[model samples]
Target chain A: MSAFRSLSLAMLKGLLRDRTASFFTLVFPLMFLLLFGALFQNDSVSRSHVLQFGEVAVLDEMPADQRRDLSEALNVEQVRDRDEALARVSDGDADAVVWQDEDGRIELRYSAADATRAGTVQGLMQSLVQSANLAETGQPPAFELASDQVEDKSIKPIQYLAPGLLGWAIAMGASFMSAFTLVNWRKKRILRRLWLAPISPGTVIGARIGVSLGMAFLQTALFLGVATIPFYGLRLTGFWWLAIPLVACGTLAFMSVGLVIGAWAKTDEAANAALQLVIMPMAFLSGSFFPLDSSPDWVRAISNAMPLKHLNEAVQGVLTRGEGWGAALPAMGGLLLFAAVLTAVAARLFRWDDT
Target chain B: MGPLNVSNAAGRPEPGATRGPTEALDAARPAPPRGPAPPRFGHGYHRQVTKNIPAIAVEGLRKRYGEVRAVDGVTFEVAHGEFYGILGPNGAGKTTTLELVEGLREPDEGSARLLGQPSWPRDPGLLRRIGVQLQASAFFEKLTAREQIHTFAALYGVSSRRADEMLETVGLTEKAGTRDDKLSGGQAQRLSIACALVHDPELVFLDEPTTGLDPQARRNLWDLLREINAQGRTVVLTTHYLDEAEILCDRVAIMDAGRILRVGAPSELIAELGVGNLEDVFLQLTGREYRE
Candidate 1:
């Protein structure tokens, strides 16, 4: 027990004292969050801008109060030329172009560059055309479609970014930290020295896990803390504390990946190459930077295989979807299983010395 | 178990060289009389075993890496309180033999018993009594000399005070606060040795501890090693330097091609082969010019 404590304290001190490691493990991921935050800062559903090419009867026939609400949700600007309006849409000057033809057929053209905005515009235009058709038929509609968010309507895209970025931060930090530390230690012969000690390998690995988990907690706090400030506008809801265990499980899974890399690679450069090959693709496919809902089926299928995706699922569920602990169980289970299997592989590949 | 009266009595150091500050301490300590050896391992008596047996006994140990016989059919014994050296060239299997004996690597054939307990399968109970310093100096990353040794001492449940004293013993007290990576090669080597000896185990294995040091640093380390052996600890060192093996080792095993060509005191082996020095002795035995 004392051995574990001393080794744990020592390992923590070593990690803290290493400036490059500290920067990569703690500061780099926060940079990712801040960058994503800035990129999505001005994007909001209530602030979508739409260009109106011609007069639309659906808008004219709407009740004044409802029309006011519609105007408030979308900024509709009159445009003279169709070509210029298409150019404006292409340049991202407008979210979409909406017009009604002489035959009373409404058309909506939106750019796919921003998938979230495109989806929102498609949904709004579909509903508007449906109502227009219903009014034209002069028959009472038997069914109406009503949609609501699981979270507050005021929640921003950055709110979702917070949890996904948090998952990414812990995953990147834990895996890179564990992999680099192991490879560095092996290169320096520290592992061989540890092997010479009276302590068991379990004690050494336990100390490492303890340190990685502590770092994960700190990362969670930092990510959420910076995100919840008014500018970033991240709001945590139902069973948000469950993110703690979820992040812990994610860290374990990623650390096992690092262990495998560290065990298999004989050099620092080799480990780094392996990490880039593994981590970067996982981050992109797992939707750490963006939502995967609009992604193709095959891409999403690959994303489902990534442990980071499950982490994002559980974290975003609690933070953005107002999900409870029960909603997080499946993802947490998947993460734990990934950690176990990779850890077994790591154990099989592990060598005390590089030779 | 094969030969209790194996022939190496002539390899013992001279009476004058054996006398030191530890002589009185050694006299005051009770010596275990030779007796019928304890039953070989697996009886669950690990700690506080009688030291009547040899410090290290290995018979016909072998390890092969692919086609290369790294340690092929090696056999030797180290007596209690003896300063033993495995002398060889770069690829002469010195490190492999040490690793096999240290239980860091499993031998493909034969056995190694350290302090009367099997070294294979890595008996954790025997670890407390053995210390190992590898050929490469490996320290905790970015740690000061003091923190490094203190952590090593803590692993053995030793006090921090003893750890600090060990740092001073290696002449590293002045650099106690210096980070290990920032220290000079000699300083790093000394720190590595200090970490190994912080617990003061009965048997210490050092593999090329002074391999890359400057002349002054090497001489200083030689004095330190002599002092460690003088304190009545059984020391096993592997070195490629003939002069280092000559000056520090009470008995030397001249190794070549993954085998021991000769084993005896440097003076005895040189005299028996009618050679002027250990370098000539190696040349005479291996039929090649010694190059390290």
Candidate 2:
């Protein structure tokens, strides 16, 4: 126990003293958060651009104020030539093309190249038609739609971004730290010296993992703490506290992944290559930066298989969607299973020295 | 005196001579006439009820990496408190042989017994009795020299005061707060040695501790090593420097191509081979210029 404690304390001190490691683990992801937060500062910012080439009655009949409000979410531009509008959408200049058929029915056409924007355009078109149909009756309906955010708090892009980015930060800190530490120790022959000590290898690894987990939790606190500042406008809600346990579960899983890479790679370059191959693709596809709802089915399918995807979803649900254990528990279960399997693989591949 | 007839050419008193069991073993066997001879291990000597065991004993130990025999069929012994050195050129299997004996790697064949206990299965009790310093110093990243030895001390359940005393013993008290990477090459080597001795183990192993140091730094480290062995601790070191082995070791093992060409006190090996020095001793054995 004393050995484990001293080793963990020493490692923690080492991490704190390593400026590059501290910057990459604790500060880099926050930079990403600030950048993404600033880019999507306004919640009402238009998501998709649509070109209306022909007279579409539903759009034409819309009130001026209502049209202005709709334009806030979707860029509706009127164009003269059908061919030109279709060409623009095909070339990815615009998201979709809107026209009316002889039957006076609204027709929306979109390109498959930008699947995420195409999905958004389709949803807006459906809602536009539905609202038009209801307004055509010109009567006060007995039942009306009443929509409000969960907990009645106005939601912003930062609120959604906070949880996803936090999950991402936790994954980065845990995995990279473990992988680099292992490879460096092996390269430096620290493992051999530790083997000569009275302490067991298990104790050394335990201390390392203990330090990694502590850094992980520190990242969680920093991410949430920074996001909750009034400037970022991230509001933590019901079951938001569940993120603590979820972060632990996710850190363990990613740390195992890192251990496997560290154990398999013989040098720093090889470990870097393996880390990039594993982490970069997962980050982009896991909906940490954007919603998977806009992604294509195949992309979403790949994202679904990634542990980071589940972590983002669970974190986003609790922090923004006002969800409880019902939503977070399944993700925790998946993360635990991921950690268990990867841990076994890490143990199988673990080597005390590069030789 | 305890049955392997290699004489001490330096005529120094037997290290740890006051130990009761060694005196008993000396009485049980007759001392042979002085001569230039390689040291040998009495096969069943340690199995006796007496505690007159050699600090290290290995017989026909071997380890192979693919087609290369890294430590092919080597055997040797070091008496208690003896300053021993394995001298060889690069890739001469010195490190591999040391590792096999240290219980850091399992031997492909044969056995290594440390202080009368089998080292292969890695007996934990034996670990407490031995210290190892690798060719490359291995420190916790970003640690200060003091913290490095302190953590090592903590692992062995040694006191922080003792760890600090070890720092002073290696003349590193002023550099105690210096980060390991910021230290000079010699300082790092001394810090590693301090860490190795922090627990005050009965046996210590150092591999190529002075390979890269300047002459001044190398001599400083030689003094520190001498002090360590003078404290009645068995010191086994491997080095490529022929003169270093001659200056520091009580007995040196000359190794080439994963085999020991000669093992005796430096003067004895030189006299027996009729060579002027160890460098000529190497040239006579391998018929090649000795290379670092």
Q: Considering every candidate listed, which one attains the maximal TM-score?
A: 1
lDDT of each: 0.80, 0.79
Question: What does candidate 1's lDDT look like per residue over A1-355, in tens digits?
Answer: 2889889988899999989879988998899899889887877654568888889877667666545556545667889898889888889889998888889888888898888778777766666667567666765442132112211333476777888888878887888879988998888888877877888989998999999999999999999899989988787786889999999999999999999999999887898899889988898899888778788999999998899998998898987678987768999999999999998999899887766
Model 1 chain B weakest 10-residue run by lDDT: B1-10
Looking at model 1, the pairs that clash are none
Kindly list the per-residue Cα lDDT of model 1 for residues B118-170, writing each as its tens digit: 88887768888999998888888888999999899988989999998898788
Best by DockQ: 2
Candidate 1 Cα lDDT to native: 0.80
Interface RMSD of each: 1.5, 1.4
Query: What are the per-residue Cα lDDT tens digits for candidate 2 across A1-355?
Result: 2899999988899888989889988999999888888788764323578899878897787777656656556778999999999999999898899999999888898999966567667777776776666566664351122111111223467866887788788888888888888899889998888888888878988888888888888888888888888878788888889988888899999998898998899887898789889888898889787766665789999999999999998988888778989888999999999989998998899888776
Clashing pairs counted in every model: 0, 0
Displacement of the residue B181 alpha carbon in candidate 2, Å: 1.6
RMSD of every prediction: 7.7, 8.0
